[model samples]
Target: MALRGLPTPLPGLAISSLLLARPAIAHDHHGGSEIPEGQTVSVEPLDTTLWIHIFVNMFAYGVIFPIGMITKSRWHVPTQIVGSMLALLGFFLGHAHGGREFVGNNVHGLFAHILQILLIAQVVLGLYLKGHWEKGINGFIRKLIRPCHSIIGKAMPVLSWTQMIFGGITALGFCQGEYTGQCAAHFIMGSAFIAYGILLTIILLVGQVWMRQTGRSQEFYDSAVIAAWGCVNTFTEHHWGTAWVRNDWQHTSMGIIWWCAGLAGIWMSRDRDGNPKRNFIPGLVIAITGWAMSSHPQELMVSEATHKMFGHTLMAAGLTRIIEVAFILGDKQSLTEDGRTWNSFQFLPIFLLYTAGFLFMGATEEQMLLVAGSDMDHVAYILILFSLASLVFLFANMLVHMYDRLANPTSSKEMNGYTGVNGRPMEEGRIRDAEEFELEGLTSDGEADDEGRGMLRRSQEGHRSQIQGVPLR
Candidate 1:
């Protein structure tokens, strides 16, 4: 526990370093196993820099991007503006590491640099899109921007997450003179988050498409079951003690419970109709487990004050979703679907949870909380501010979608109902009286009715706004 140059991220400070029950602290805390004799670096961990850099990275990618993407509001470009600034700061600090970890025989320096260069390209491309080009070429540029923006946007975040995974394994690619290894638990949890993000995204995309076409809700059922198994793993597996591994043997028990519960939920969710929305246990399981996992209270209130509360927010969101379903509010769609709709409001808790996780990861690290930890604090503050700004946009979007965002409120199930050939209902001959069923939220021009008053109408945008005469992404 030597105090040297600049500090690094969570696990390395002189004071007791605790991150989610596992110590990601540098060398000396636990005499990690050594690499081959020829492969020891004289590098140091940039725990403090990482605190600000990586935390900001996650916040921008996980929270703000999604908000702007969903809403397409005036704040969208500004969100990118703030995000790009944070990224510059991160890259500056990341470069401060000076490739120390690769001084030894085993070098991952090349991989790290490649990732950084790619990130730079993504940022430049983003900025390029904001600038205007000549008219004839502008259309061509816009075409390029579409695929480029969409692909780079998706790739960068996943790549960034993967880098974090590597950083954890390599302890940010720097250690004193010797390094054994950081705890494997941290690695496992990071992997789990990555898995969670990817799965949630896939399920949401799938669910959105499926619901639009078939109107069956397989996404919710499957997601809930997965959440249950994860919950069982959390409660039964995490060995939470000041010291000792008492339940070393019980590691497999919770995993088994997870399996059984998931299988049972899936099997029982069926009523011989192959329908998915008949049961709500899967959603409940995910909600409860999310809350339960984040429920651990810290013994000390100094650094990680709202540590438990971070998890609680996500848990609360899940619970709110369940309530929405039970009370049969307008929130009856798949909870994790990424598409924007009124039902998406129920998914806000998960979004908040992800943001809060970024916040806690930044602010609570003992190293990040040290004297002169202002940079880390600033990064955390910016992240929060961006989120708050995004919230204004999100709240308005939510209000606009408070009723039947998922489907046309006036659409009849019987119209797209089970009455026709091959389950596809025929369109009625014609409307005898068009005004009799004019549709709930539309004008004759096919734009949302904006002249109306009320929260729903006030929040509604007749159409997406243009930036400098250009349509926004």
Candidate 2:
């Protein structure tokens, strides 16, 4: 995962060779069909109104909601509330016009319904906060509220991306019939979804360690399952023991490596001397995720090169994390928060992706480039510059959050104000640790049996503080 020591020649050769030999790559990867020599796929206008609705859906749910979650400003709530309503409206309209046909499959329809429920639930949570009261909800439901909030909250981005990708895949191309061929757009974005999933797994594991959850048999169980899948994906993607590993394959291979490292940590943790060393796995995870997206074909091309630069920046941050973890653990200190706190250095990669995502938006415009440097397009370059401006905006927002955390920090008594995952302020004072979040049927005070709900340790006065009502009128 460390870019400095790892040789790049293998991946470089793989990319170059793939480009030169793509004709023979067996077009069986995506589907049996192939695009006629010079044709390409594109976004459609089921008319202007449909096009506008979907983009608005994408921007509101994918962009604005996530940005609010990342920055966690109080001002973000009003905007997010508005965006949620708009996104829900858009979902209904889009579904009526486009997604209705897919209901027979059950998969897409199920997810669509889940997303709608999540949106309604989020709106309810926002209003509850605005009300500054929780009498209408139950104590246990309130205790489990943040975790529920977090699951749906974190899911919105992944769910949005899923819907978008499938929507694109299922829709007829603007200029053609069904697009049953390989889509570069789908591949790139789909890989990001996988990458984000792995990251959350690692972050949750690391968070548990910092909070002193030493008894982690369940944690190991989860890691073992994820690693097993990674191992399966490794072979499935053709990345094992091969001389030339494709960049996409490298991603799965690294997932395998990360899982192996995690398994090692789990085994070692039983030795009583391995507590300080258990964090190496997560550090390596960050490093791998950082570089996994770097080794693609257009590594040095226009915005493609910029994307690689973005990848390396994340790699550097990963290396820094590794070093920091070593230093802190060596001195018998706690592990740093990953993505949950305003004070976390863990937010770095998230920021990198958002800013870099815009750059990649135009990187996909490579098909528009003409022959030779003389006829090349400048749109991607302009977008790359716009991405940098976005970086500045994000940087400024991060600075404000850091400043706020310093200026108006929360105490253990005010656990509700911490805004658990994705900035959804908890309705109940029950702040469950991320470790046992998945096992819903467990008490926060103790582990749960299979049939029981996870009992979250609701704060008495420690969990509740004086509430001042804000007039919604």
Candidate 2, 119-150: lDDT as tens digits: 88877765554443445565455656656666
Span of ten consecutive residues with least summed lDDT in model 1: 1-10
Query: What value of lDDT does candidate 2 attain over all alpha carbons?
Result: 0.46
Q: What is the lDDT of residue 251 in candidate 1?
A: 37
Ten consecutive residues with minimal summed lDDT in candidate 2? 1-10
Poorly placed runs, candidate 1 (over 4 Å): 1-110, 114-153, 164-209, 212-257, 290-299, 302-304, 328-340, 343-345, 359-473
The deviation in Å at residue 13 for candidate 2 is: 29
Alpha carbon lDDT of each predicted model: 0.43, 0.46
What TM-score, over all chains together, does every model reach? 0.44, 0.47
Per-residue lDDT of 432 in model 1: 11
C-alpha lDDT (0 to 100) for residue 325 of candidate 2: 48
Q: What does candidate 1 score on TM?
A: 0.44
Task: Kindly list the per-residue Cα lDDT of model 1 for residues 1-473, writing each as its tens digit.
Answer: 11110112232221112121222222231235233344443344545665666677556644554444443333556766676666666666654543233232222233456556765776677666655443687868867876887686656654555445445434443322322222223233323432443344343433455554564555345645464544555453445674434343233343444455566666654457765443555455445544543543343343333444544554665565456555543334543343433355544544543444343333333333341345444435535633753563354335335223223233222431344465433222122112222333233223443444244432332211211233222
